[model samples]
Target: MSSTPSASLFKPLQEGDPGDVGGYRLAAVLGTGGMGKVYLSYTPGGRPIALKVIRPEFSEDPEFRRRFKQEVQAAQRVQGLYTAPVIDFDTDGAQPWLATAYVPGPSLAHAVAQHGGLPLRSVLLLTVGVAEALTVIHGAGIVHRDLKPANVLLASDGPRVIDFGIARAADTTALTGTGVSVGTPAFMAPEQASAGTVTPATDVFALGQIAAFAAIGSPAYGEGSSHAVLYRIVHEDPDLSRLPTELLPMVTRCLSREPADRPSLTEIIGLCHELSPTALHQGEDWLPQTVADSITERLRLPGPARTPQPMPTVAPTPTEVSPSTPPPGTVDPYAPTGLATPSAPGAPGPVRPRAPEPPAPGHHTATPGYPANHTPPPVTHQPSAPQVRQKSRRTGLIVAASVVGTLVVLGVIGSLLSDGGGKEENKGAGAPATSSGPTGGDGGAGAGQQRKDPKPVSYQGIDLTDGYQLMLADNPPRPVQSEDAAYDGGDLYFKVVNFLDESSIGTDNGKLVLLDNARKGSLETCRTETRYTEKIDLDQLTQGSQICVLSDAGHVAVATYRGRSSESDPGSYVTLDLQIWRNAQETDGN
Candidate 1:
């Protein structure tokens, strides 16, 4: 296995991101999720670690903090060959963070996406490693509530399970209140989906899903929205017909709906051993050539520098001034500009006179536009008589009317310029103005702009076959051959084989959320909805069925199924109208 460190694995810390936390200097951003960011850092002795900083909302809760401390202690005790152990942590701080031994390899999800499903032997070996890791984890009285493919790192030595006991701590937090599920939708156990008791068996169910995903390149329960997947896990049986014959019996037993019916970790390890007697002896050759090469590339990347980069500082916005407050670029004559010097220890300090009292409400002591050293003359009672007050009121009304008149003229001129400029710009760009339903191509100008509803973009006549995969993230979305280099980054794949007339659309790096009866203007619904899945079966939909696809590039696209090309051959070809909202988060008008 290559031990080279690749720099491409790390992204530079962004502005306002802390350069260092505790004593460890952050090298770069490892990744980010809803929980918080993970940074690549090194110990004082130079050993690399993945430091995960909890988000403020989670860390600020006293209940979460107390649970976090307990979990960190249990996680530190977890020591196994296939698990990344927590080495250091600080739960007492304002933002609690924990450091784990960094595993220099792509996640199982990334590896499978880059290279197709793993060979049968490789899957068997992966099962053995993960099962053993679970044995050690369960022995330490910790249940890995969430054990999806992304949490498993494929190292040269073997698979290393990460985020083991962390999920338990998060489950107790207010973020995951009562009756809410904590794990990923596709891999969640029946009990977890229904918010029932979770045990080590819950991890076993997820492990089975991971194994099936590695061998079949998609989840067994079939995916769409989180609700759909969770409903199927709780009510419907998993479609394991596509699973390899050698691994069928084991995976079936592991995915049993009832927790008690699921096989124990020891039984799972034994089952894997039966499938591949020499699984332990596969060594570095266990992974396929493509996956092995990916791991080698990741290991060869150079580690980040130890020195911390300076954090960028943003100038504070100027405060709005009221009648009593001093305006910007001007100083108050009555306010002190310098501070008194500190006196020597135990020495008598000079007696300083008290400052003047503040002006009463609705009164101004300092004159406008005055210099720092300029002091205004003392007020006289002669100017405050009733006749003088009337004159001042009339002057104020005149100034206010003049200001309003100037603003009205400026508004008219600005509106005219904006309309003319917008028309000319759109004409030069050759973009459409009126909404003519969904049409594809960056969703035009108004697609992701703030405060305006995104225009729907359509993609018609899309064909889905066995060897060709759909690339939703690409401009002018199209399909490419399974063996094509584009397939590595492709979002969805359709598989059709004999005996298993199953046809499904599955993604590796993106999510597909089903919207049952949505129309053309479903972009806003897609952007706001949170439930997402990796794949969805064609049999579950009908004509005019809408599906929202959150692309790998963070673009929200709505895929409206426009029926199949041929009724006899449903999987041969299908039509879809897409409305892609780019920069999905910006559509919220933040």
Candidate 2:
């Protein structure tokens, strides 16, 4: 290891800080975040590690500890070439902490802030590494909800994604409050901004934002107050004007408003591959030279120096005596003792033992005979014979249950097949004696005719600007200005010019119907016959009210009114959660 310390990379420990924790000596404070502080330390074998110690407030909370323990266990199972795997953790301690292999490099955020944006080639390579890391992370059933530039580190090998699932454990706690979002506002996906369901796709949206940030040196949505940025993310499209030409398409697809519209991690890797075939193997030159130099400087930092505690001497007992033993405090002349024998008159007659030195405050004393850097092996408990037998019995019961469940499933399938056979025979015999149900096919089996309705596409928290019309028939619906929304230009129009009294949703050429009792309406509820009108006043409708519409293009849509976009700014327009069924005529037989 290189022994050149860079003062910039470390800060001296403050007063009252522990010198040693769980056998790892704290060299310096690496960094601090909202949740806790990170320290640079070394393992028993002299391997460097980044140890994260939880803050007292978070550790003391019972709920945080419970969630933290679960997250730690799951994190330990995450193993990826582009990730720093958890090597050790202590969740049940007063202050829960975990250790991971130290990455001697600056974070992407710091690198970019110190230097400018990276070159196109370096950004492509960074994408490949992070995408690969996400693949491994999601495979382990964990989402890296916080994938900002700060959570990505630039090393000589490649980019490493850190702080994977830790954000989730801190989410919805008293510290953050219930229903509050848990990610950086600049990089948050639209769904996250609206309190919608978050999934793996949420990370993909953040990934796109990261790429834009790396190539353009600023956030996709211009930086400002959190509220303003979130509003843009939910209502406005990202400003990709400054992004590199080659990266625009991939980034755009990843930033699609609907979660279903974003590309998968696999697709992202393929796009990176197309841009640079050898992106993953760029090695030390993957980062720009200036950033690479920073990594070099960090690698040269020296390890923490630990003072070895002196071992106490004990008189030999009769059971430990042997023929080769020397007299107390006297060295055998023929033996090659490393120490010099006391022969001078003024020399001490017998070497007097000194009391062991007390360890520094907040520091644990080193164990006798072991080096200061040595860490004892962890203790493990083995199951007893009785416990093993009990486990075997439980396994047998589980196996028996599985067999019974399989038989039940098979029987159900056989019965369904039998019923289907009877129906086919009746059709062949031309038997048509059945009571009529609903007027249309309605995705039901009617008189031996089997029909299925197309699945409705759902979009949540879609904002419609005042005076602009929304095109619900579009694959992923979009908004169009009123002038462009002529005859068949759009589906629903937001009329906010007359305030709450006259503000309503109306189709210029089609029709609208209010579904009073169907607040939780779906495609089935929309199929029932109801009076259709050109417009429905907003003043009479409350939040959570449902409106079914037949667009000018002949497509059917169910819109749930989600109230105005901003309560403080009444002119900001309203929000709607929508579900649209395309080609409605085929199902309705109109």
Candidate 3:
């Protein structure tokens, strides 16, 4: 193990950080170490993941990568509550990185610091959860070298074991130098600090220390420098005096100086269940009430405040005539439904005003508690009265011109017949006087209707619930092989995407899309078989809302993770409340 100090916690990537680590987009720096930097990244499906990127100098060592690869294989076999299972890794990269499922909760260390020591009941629940997690870890023949508060997460259902960056199998080539220690000194077991042979018992010791920290808000051995803490762990007894009296005995046994003297994981789990009968599980309150409230606020999705505006329209051209029983211009305010005829000029025709058309039967004004009114308003071009008259006069001129032209044509025919010595009058009379069928009194526009352009269809955002986390990729979802197509579009509109089948969605699939200007822009036309990416935008979050997104097997989700914007970096950042999605009901969504 390297000797550098642990200088950071999960933080945003600093300058010089790689945008892409091992092809995964590095989103944030999870923590920093002497040997490497842990990054927060995601798989192709938009699933957030934690990546531990080993330092360059270490990656240069072939033996190190080989051992790293071997441990990765071993850790893969471990699956349990509380443990973050390894999903992928690259042991041979220039700077190797390991990726694991990104847990959605905060670390135990953060929890204790924020909320103080957990309540007794909560401590018991944590014990059961962590012990169950440890059982799985030990069962895989791996000893978690660093089982500290920072490595335990308080998930909705239970505690999740994470950060196995220093975990090693019971029987493997020790990856570190021959006589070096390889874990946090405060939580390290006696054997680890002394560079002695370690067994599963070493993890039990660390677990005890974690429990003590969670209970008393401090390490069992108390705080000190690395050397002092290590000396205390190896030579002195754990100061469990601060732990609750009832819990002292069990904690002491787990912290036994002799590894063989410690209680087995099975026995520890039994004690935990006996102490807290209602163990944490699905659909239960695993965290304290306040913490849960904070979590809920964080994941609440604020409804967008602004609705889409209607498109601007130009007034329609005026009609010339109307089919009416009344004399010229005596028709109702509007022309008769089908026909358009010139209206009388000079405004003396006083037709009584009609009632408001009874609001089209069911159409009500925007009054609250009124019965439903589904009828829409009439589409009115509403041409001005003077403009209407001008159009009517123009229509009359066209009609007069047409009539003159027809008479001239008829006269010409009669003259031709007379010259040929035929019955000219008969020839002229026999010819039908049909005038090319201009309807009586109606101008160019008649009962024949014109179609109007259709209105736009738009979508809205929703608040997300538990069991889901989502983040819109900084890069819009587009075809993997397609040439990069980037553009600066205005405000976003969101849509939930449903994958056709479970297998259809993966790391590279299930992205949400936001179609800009739905009225003018085209909706995506990807194949029905599967879709992974869509250009989506989340800007203009309802100024005060916390937004979250979730990607389950075949469902896309979004939720509120926090209630307020970050105090330190107000508009500059928004943290997405993310969680791994699973199951068919996720398709239905909450």
| lDDT for each candidate structure | 0.67, 0.71, 0.51
**Candidate 3 local lDDT, 227-306, one digit each (tens):** 89889988988887779876787899999989889998889878776766465444457678866654443222111111
Q: Which window of 10 residues has the lowest lDDT sum in candidate 1?
A: 344-353
**Which of candidates 1 and 3 is the stronger one according to TM-score?**
1
TM-score of each: 0.51, 0.54, 0.47
Question: How are the candidates ranked when ordered by lDDT, highest leading?
Answer: 2, 1, 3
Q: Pick the candidate with the highest TM-score.
A: 2
In model 2, pairs of residues that clash are: none
| Superior by lDDT: candidate 1 or candidate 2 | 2
In angstroms, the error of model 2 at 567 is 34
Q: Give the TM-score of candidate 1.
A: 0.51
lDDT of 2 by residue, 1-590 (tens): 33446556776566566656676667677888777889887766677888899888778777787677656644654678999877666666668787787898989899989997888889998898899999888765567788999999999989999989888777756877643445688998998889845688999999999899999888999988889999999999999998888999999999999988999989998988887745356588888889998998787644555333323244434433232334467544433222233232111112222222332211222233443222323235453222112334778989999999999999888856756845555444555545333324433455445444556776655556567676665433444446653434557888665443567678885677798763566666666747888878877688888888776554788888888744322134567778887766343335
Estimate the overall C-alpha local distance difference test score of candidate 2: 0.71
